[model samples]
Target: MASKHDIPLTGSSVNIVKKCGPALNDILNSKFGCGATFSGVDFERDLSIAHQKSSYVGPDRRFGVTLHSGVEVSVWKADLTNLSVDAVVNAANTDLQHVGGLAWALSKAGGPQIQRDSDDHIRKNGPLLTGEAIISAPGKLPCKNIIHAVGPQLTDPSYISSAEPFLEKAINSILDRVKTNKLNTVAIPAISSGLFNYPLPQCANTIVKTVKRYYEGVFFNIGHIPKEILLVNHDDLTVQEMERACREILAPHLAVPNSQTTARKTRSAAKTSTPTVQIANVCLTLMKGRIEDQPTDVIVNTASPDLKLSTGEISKALLQKAGPEIQNAIKNTPPKGYVIRTPSYKLPCKEVYHTRCTDRGAHGAEKVLWKSVSDCLWLTAASFYKSIAFPAIGTGNLKFTRKESARILLDAVNQFAQNSTQKMNVYFVIFPSDHGTFQAFEEQMKWLQAPRGPTPEASEKRDPFPNTRTPPPQISLTGPSIESLFEADKWLGHLFKSSGTIEIYNNFIQHFSHNDYVQLSRLQQNGVSVEEFFTAGHACITLNGPSDEVAVAALQVEAMLCSVQKDFVAEEEGEMLLLSSAGNNVPFERKRVDRSTQEFKDKAAAFHKQGLRISKLDKVENSTLQLLFNLKKNQLQCHATEEMFQRVPAQFCEMVSHVGFHAEFAPPEDPAYGEGIYFASTAKKAMEVWKGKREEYLYFVEAEVLTGSSVPGRRGLFLPPALGTEPLRVHDSVSGGSDISVIFSGYQALPKYIITCQK
Candidate 1:
């Protein structure tokens, strides 16, 4: 019989009972005088209630899998201090401060005594190095003891080179404590990920692997094993990552029925060689050498899901030879299970296909590997690449056995060749150090070539002496282009000297006006060359220069036209004296001419009498007056222009000039849309906008036709071209449609009229 007080306080309390059933009962009865009896009913009833309350369960009771050494591992998303295990491991800094993440939370929940014990240990031991751990009594936590483990600070560049070994040592030290104390159950959190900066996936894989190895007696003496190990984390992301790691590394070993028998079979199979057989129009060859040294069209580099190249062996060799550009390219693209192509740099191959097949866990390992190999084959065939080579994808850091890796790779290649229409030569290149893997592949190849069935199509076309001749050195015309170099190194501003050209035309208005020619002259003075031509109601302007120079020239021309239009409006309303002094000063030098005629003096005096004061005036041409003025009553005036009007209103031809230009550099978009149009104050901003739009549309400049026959009232209205006139056509590769035209709605009214066509 059991009293209500003894019926386990919570789920954690029930876990304690389940973990140390008889031992816990005896301790409680003797120490606290809470007499509790245990039976199948009592255990089940209490466990069910505790589960309903908090959902905590012991590892052995939770996951029904047994390790080789009979130890069971489970993952739980729960607070470390609340777990009712023999001990909980804390990822502690060398100084052992309860500062952040798991360490901080554990200290707060477990009371100050945990910290006090840690202080005492630190005082005696100086400071704990990575891979060292000390055990202290758990003050208020449910666990019996706390293992403060110092793991490497992976964020530190110096420690990154030795992160794995240090991580392994930390796990081993914790296990050492557990074995010495003969504890049955323990809970651990992901070490070094919070402030230490170890990557979550790598941390998860390393921890699971280290623990698995420990349980298998790789680190400890035989017959010493903890009954249950719980990989616990309070954070959702960390828990998910650990769960995946366990599934991939531990679950496979536990789930496999008759794993020992399977191992024995695999070992026996590796001892014997298999004959090779051809499946389709593809021949598979295995050779032992450095993959980077192979003369193939492309070589495959096994990368992590993040496309992080490994630090050792073939991957390291590839990275060293390929330079940093390859890594940068990989980062710009999407990672995961996709295949990426990059220049091989100094490698023997023309290109390298970087693919990710690691960390896929046990169940998805085969599927991920197949997709990687299949994608490589398909891409090679589509590109007409004759030969491609592969390394043992997951057999290295991922811990997949060589035998299984060979089988999966060979099967994928075989299946692809059978269905794909293109023919290719596939080679499996292995390094000399990987002799076991090489033997495994050799055996599989031998078995495949065994004559058990009718001769296959691939066999008929196979070269009799395939290994005798080396592939001829491929002629590589694929050196780094200047465009690629510019893309790679944008900070090299001198590279902007490269130039391109585009031509623009408009059928509505023919010929460049005096103002248009003046603007073009100004551009030529500033490094841009603008060629203008006109014939029978159609005008064209060809602009060529460095990208920045062209952009600046176009912007200045737009500003000048806009200034002219404003002046025309002011002159027509008899408000020409209202031009602001702050408006754009003419870029070209202006010459002043004395106006002494009696009629001009009379008109000027009359304008002054009407409360208008012309602050400054200059002659634009023979009869034109460029005036800067303001109202006497108030300073109501625009600031982006200082020039006023042309003398003859009807002769003020609203000339539409179609202008085209190209830039070598692509600029980012401007946050301010119309920043530089009025004053050319935002030249950088205008260039950004131009380049951003250039990505999608072909650009043109169109000036409205203000002819002698135009009606004064309909000056700025939208007017179509003559009925029989042909529409101007501009060819643009960026836009999809062939005959898409973008009209400038208010070309006459706007200071700058920029026309764009879809294609």
Candidate 2:
């Protein structure tokens, strides 16, 4: 190690001396940006010791996005050791040896405890795979915990293909630790970007993307996670890359204009070669290419019984291309029936429809396949997407023949195309390497054109009606001769009007229990043909009539289908509710304050300066007071009752910890603000936000909330609406009427401390 005297008085070192008087000797002695050691000071040290006691970062940016729950995701150029978060993530290898790079720096600062705990952990659990992670107790470091995650190395073969998945695993493992341990904030370096030989930009992108993806799940799932995620790095390049990635991947959306979203062809694709045919209003096309690369509104990915995307070759490929973010999305919001819908990460498509057809036996195999394929189409239409690309599903590990699977799957598509009263482009994409599957699908596509029902020419030829005169049937009606002629003429008209038949497969079974029979009877009374049948273990509903009547009936049937789906989702939510309320269900940390510490005096002063007398500060670590622990956290909030501010992102906070989403996203009784949870920028504002109708009984929640870009708000708005008349961008939040801010999503805010005070 370099001697203390060898250190230079650089900008940060010089500033340290100026801010902290009479610490010249200590400031000149310590090394800065050295990965092997960190002073592990609190974030407030931004104002404190350098002997120059500098925190891990050099000034760069918090360039990040605040999620729905008030979680702040920031990227900074700083040393990892300087951060005083609840936990710091260490990029480690399999053996738990802290020999070099970030591992050495963290181990050095944290002292021998890290090594000892790591060795013991590895000794008991064995070596970790590239994506696996383990947690270690902090030794001498300022943070309370450490998470050790293994990332991929360039030395491994086909690391490109393997790296994304492994890297994602490593990132997720770290996040999982944060969630399980209930760490309010976690600092993570770019894993694999050091000596592991992973490319810096890709490594940073994957990490940022995974973090964003994880938060997305938190928003959807109401899962408990850290309030803040810090992407801390000592070097400028890595930090820059991290910032770039966060900006690109987590950039907030602007209100988009209503523009046509047409499917664009890949540069390499030959438009003339794709086999296509029209079925009613839909264009059925067969293309041989990678399903993940198709630029469609939605693409299909086959999953296993567990609904994990990594279990099959096709799904594994999609997951790899999509990165681990997809996995995070999958685990948080499980599949309802045969399919789970997630926003696609790295894939070209907008959404990935993960379908499971795990019935290995022949008995119910076709039924499941029908459900999987039909579900994808049904969801595609429901989302109002004009196009969807599906992979050849029946063939791979499920072991069905290419021909049989193609025919069965396409049969579902053919059925959907005929029934849907909307314009759609349906694509069956075969993997480029799988020539046989392409041939099977291609042949089936031609057969789809051959005839699903009798054509006009074929019908005329079969009946000999157009070319030859039909023999007049003897009409025996108790009326005049004209009546007999009319009855004879009406017989031909019945044969001439063709029935528009639509067949639906794999009912959710519960639909029958809920007005489906009554609804079907209503259709019959309205002159729409309806039939219900059972195949394998599932129920089927078919509707037939004139095109317009069938179309109308189709709308009602779609509603029933949606109701059936609601049952599965609603059931899952009920289970989550039960799991959210007990011990360890929601994670918050509390430690009694040491009122004797000098730091407490300073924080108390900061608090008193805000025009409020603290009856008490319930919890404190030594002398410091911090309300934001990562959830783009602010200091603290004072609850209000009966006042205008009493209503927060009204009900959003109530739905924390799988404590999922509020029906209206506004404050409890006030939806006038933007549709999001509320946060205040200052201590005074925080006090105002939570100050209740009464003063004696007071409650405050210290939280990390990410309130990024904001604009003024009005009541009754659900999400941050578009900011301008021309741009497609929407504000991340709205400045609340109560001198506060409101964010739409729950994931952006993480509740850290709950302090009760008496006035």
Candidate 3:
């Protein structure tokens, strides 16, 4: 709690706040119930200042950029009536009645003349159809003219199917109005996305892409006429989406395809964008999306102390997807702590954690928030969950400002990253409509990523490795003070040592001679690898070599997880270098890459990016390049295992050893942990699970199981659950409490010793 209250804004944070203008002076003189303080170990005050700095972008806060075609596209969250554009586009219904949503607000600002003009247009032209538009003179509004465009209503199920095409037409109609009136500037809201039930991302993409394409003369004759077109919305989420759409659509070496071709274009892209910030092995990200769609191991919600989902949009959506079991569980359970955990019955995620704050900003809201967030993260990591997604949930009543809540959420993650040593992916998902909170988080991330001068060694220049496009992003927060930072560099020297060596690699990272960026998590397998976390953010992963060397070559082992789910994914990162047990000749650079086909060149280039050797001698003729590679199979041996199971059919008792299903006497398949080999914490627990009248030679293997990112072990499961966000990658193993450790794949575990007992 002390850590939650008296928090310091690192040396870099202090440097940032000292530069704030009058806001600094105002905070210094201001008086409040809790008393705010910035850069003076006050989390709340520093957060407020951060919000102010992020929100204020000069006098007008114009978030705009000029395109290559000299068309200035400005996207910002603001009142349309306040912006003095030549023409403003209104998202109107068929009858053009400005009664609800943004339409009413615009009409209220413009007075009764707008309604009268709309009525006149409808009477003269008989109710305007969807995708149609009618122009009207500005009546007390800031803009010179108004383009009342009829956008498709997405809420209607019958019209939902035709919404996209109609929405496109509506945008084109607005642009046509611009051309007809020769308007130099226009502001358009995200049509059909308000109460009309259209999605924000699609709405934004459609509008921005259409505008860009229209300017490029993709649409009949609607070429770039207006010097500036503003994609203004009242909410920051929509504005941010527009900005993102603009960047992605206009990036260099980029081509945006229509909806029909989107599938093909998206599939070719291998990697998505990186997290906002990466600390040690933890990646903290901010996503603008619905929590229900977030693919994480756990979905965290701020709930009542009794563990009930509130009647909010996010909660309703999740409840609807998960069925009524969650609500039913709440009725049966007693009052819990700040946090409670539940299994996701029908939801995409494995589990759900709910926390309570009750009061957000009244008094000591920071402590309550800190506990909720910290506990959720700690619990998730403890359960070996890889990822967790959190929505902007707060004080039972949604009375707190988005900025306050945003700051608290980020602060919690920051604290966790500072102290955590686990490799975790944490996502703070904001619904696309909450702009203020999104911007707050975006600003905090920018400040957090600021270079804190942790290591002066980062300033040094290093020789570039061959064939790597860019170096992997890894920073030494505390420099390489440990003696065993890169143990892989010294492995060759210790290979032939005929004894069990006790070499310690605090951080087992392999630096590829060809490319320093290529990281190999596992060098070998068979020994124990311990994991620990402290206040200092550092994670240690150790690997032990195979036992075929007649001596213990390595103490720690990094196990390679095998899964049937990853059939489509490549087994290795790229062209893997095989290490043979027997001494063999190093591969010679003699093989020439065939240059006749473009396909061969593309394959060679792709392999080159993954640090595969491709040498071209200066004196070589015919533009020949030599490739040095000798890929061999890496296999693991399975030891004899024995276990008991309930009486069942022979097919159910059958086991898979290495290749496929065989009639081998392996451990019985247990669905409690995905039908895998279950290991008890002790022999007593093993006996309790599988004891029978004929149990005499009772035993279990004390193997080094690779529990990468596990989910709860439930009945009827065949394989380990898929990794959070990656449906193709399954968890290395499944876990079930203090009694059992379920190894889904034989390759994921190595039998170290056997515990035999007689009952």
Candidate 4:
């Protein structure tokens, strides 16, 4: 219902009279219904003529406001093409053709150059897909560049719900380009509202909301985003609609207080004297410093699967202090999601427990984080260590946010404390530089200290230690029996059963050590002294008796093995049990060895030593030739013209060729003679020629020839037959008039077996 006159004009609005002068007052009044009286002029006709001759030069200012994130957003009723900004957005079709209302206007004002560039882009990359955008140099427009954003066509009823996401994509694509190109300001049209028929209000809401969210989300990373985002439209009605949408949608978000301020206020209001959780025999303390400096009974090191001890700052520092012995002990160990104990060495702590934790953003990162912490506690408890220090496991280079890392870590420690019978002191050691991490832990501590109500029955049932020695009433594992394990009592019983524990350990070792000698060596090196069972089928090992050095070494070895096993399982599955002793100290390094060339050399030498004439041919030509070597018959047959037979060696010229060589000769010393010679033999013998040296053999031909020319002629071996030991029937015409023939048989280069044959 609001008219142009009703809209409030800001102080920046350009006065029409100031621009047009007194002569055009009568003309403006007649055309735009303005009724302003001049001091002394009644020249209405002259004013009308003057107004017709003049044109407006500047932007049509409407309304603008600065959002809470310090981004300037404006609603302007003016031609977008005329606005001088870094770029202007065009609501475009997926084809990127400038055919619609705004698109056509932009194309016209910008000249044919814009359309030509868009057409060229379409030709090269096909049509631009929906919810995507591309930039083009503005032709004659005031803006430097034009961003063509493709939104979903709302013509289909099914696409209604998807409009918001499409609009969001369009807005984000433009913003991304702006940031990438370091553009300061941009003007965007009311996208998808005209012939696209998207409702104006919804479109406006989407645009404003998307912009506000972008600024708010990236506020921390980029202090200054786009300096100004102008929502421009030539139509007055569209401008008014956008302004209204901005007030209703964006204003609320701006008015709300920042989240950090809100959190502080909430904490102050909930302040209390009593602690949030009070356990029987455990204490939780937060300390800020290097984990190595913490004087706990043991410290947990966040490590990778390779056990290189060179990833995070904490890891590097620990490794430097722990010395090379710790690295050497655990180098062969696989890194599973379990704790590995190693000697603290020069460290302040008595021992070190290492575990691999994933990035916070990865799948099941929370579960893995919890398991790492829990395993460390369980190992500490079993080893009879009263205190353990834990560094923020995944918070370092793993990119786990401080808040999430703290929450998961604290929850794990709290759960462990609630059920442990022995008194334990848990220290959360944080780096001095990570203030946010320290604050997160501090907040958690405050929350834990706040007074709470009675403990829930569900939580009480989750005891860290349940009686594991008691046997089940019977040993039946049928459907009902298996289903019964889901029950609380039965499940607890199943966890403690000696048979179950052994089965789990067997399975764990079998799966981890199968075909993996490194992991097997790690397990064997870290001798399994005693297996400590826990709730939920979790188990860890300790030294056979009470030797600290042996215990630390074993734990480190097992932890390394577990890490490697996890990586191998992620790759593929097999069941080849290969166990090796960790004490062997033989480093297993895998390298690629090519033996094909060597195999060829050995084969060539053997042929020579056995007194066979090796005639290296550079070229051979024949047609309708048949060379058949029958392995079962132990004979060679040839069918060819007399000229072809005469051209070949007299030893192989007979109609029925013999298996043995006609002349005695040593292996050829020249490289040319060595490479091209082929030995006539059975398929079985030929296949075995390169058995252990297949990779080094370079000769391409491996087929059993049935017909046609097999030799490469006097020039050289043109191309070895197909690269396989399988017998094949080959028939082809040759350019030469003469036809040559030889018995078909498997061939091998002598170099493959020269060393072995000579020995």
Which structure among the candidates has the greatest TM-score?
A: 3
Q: What would the TM-scores of all predictions be?
A: 0.27, 0.28, 0.31, 0.27
Q: Write the per-residue lDDT of candidate 4 for residues 1-759, one digit (tens) a residue.
A: 101111111221112222222322222222122222221111111111110211213565566778777888888777776888999999888766664367766877898899889889989999887779888899999899999998766765456677879888988898888877788899988888875767777888889988888888677876447789998886545676787777677664444443565465543332321122334335677766788788889999988856778767788999888787888766755553477777788888998888877766788777778888988886676455778988877777778777667767876786665434335778887776566676667665654543353222234322223442322122111111111112212322322232311222212332333223322233333243444343222233333422332323332333333344334433321111111112222121112123345644544454455443222211121110111123212232333312111111111211111111111111112212112222334322323322222221111112233333443333222333442454463322112112222322221110111111211
Q: Write one digit per residue (lDDT tens) for candidate 3, span 363-468.
A: 7666677668878987776565789999876622656666566656766776666544445789988877565566556655654554352211354222111232
Could you tally the backbone clashes for each prediction? 16, 63, 4, 54
Model 2 local distance difference test score: 0.59
What ranges in model 1 sit over 4 Å off?
1-64, 156-161, 217-220, 253-759
- Superposition TM-score, candidate 2 onto the true structure: 0.28
lDDT of each: 0.53, 0.59, 0.52, 0.51
Q: How close is candidate 1 to the true structure, as a TM-score?
A: 0.27
Q: lDDT tens digits, residues 1-759, model 1?
A: 111211212323333333333233222222222223332212211111100122223332224356878888888767676788899999988877764456766776788888788888879889898799988898898999999999887535555657899999999999899888888988888888765678777889999999988887573465568898888875445665787788788886544443364355664454442223334446577766788888899999887656666554767789887777778877786643458888788888988998776553666666777778878886676455778999988788777778777767876786566444334678887775566887777655644544343322334423222343432211111111222222212211212222434333322113234324533565575467887665322245666876555533433333333334444444433432223333223222223223475644643464355343322223222111122221311222222322111111111211211111101011112212111111111222223233432222222222111111111111122232322354543111110022111122211111122222222
Give residue 328's lDDT in candidate 4 (0 to 100): 74
Task: lDDT for model 1, please.
Answer: 0.53
Candidate 2 lDDT, tens digit per residue, 650-755? Answer: 1122222223323222233333564456666555665555444543333444455555666888866767878688456677677765457776754445544333
Candidate 1 lDDT score at position 193: 76
Task: Give the worst 10-residue stretch by lDDT in candidate 2.
Answer: 28-37
Question: For candidate 4, what is the lDDT?
Answer: 0.51
Residue 144 shift from truth in candidate 2, angstroms: 76
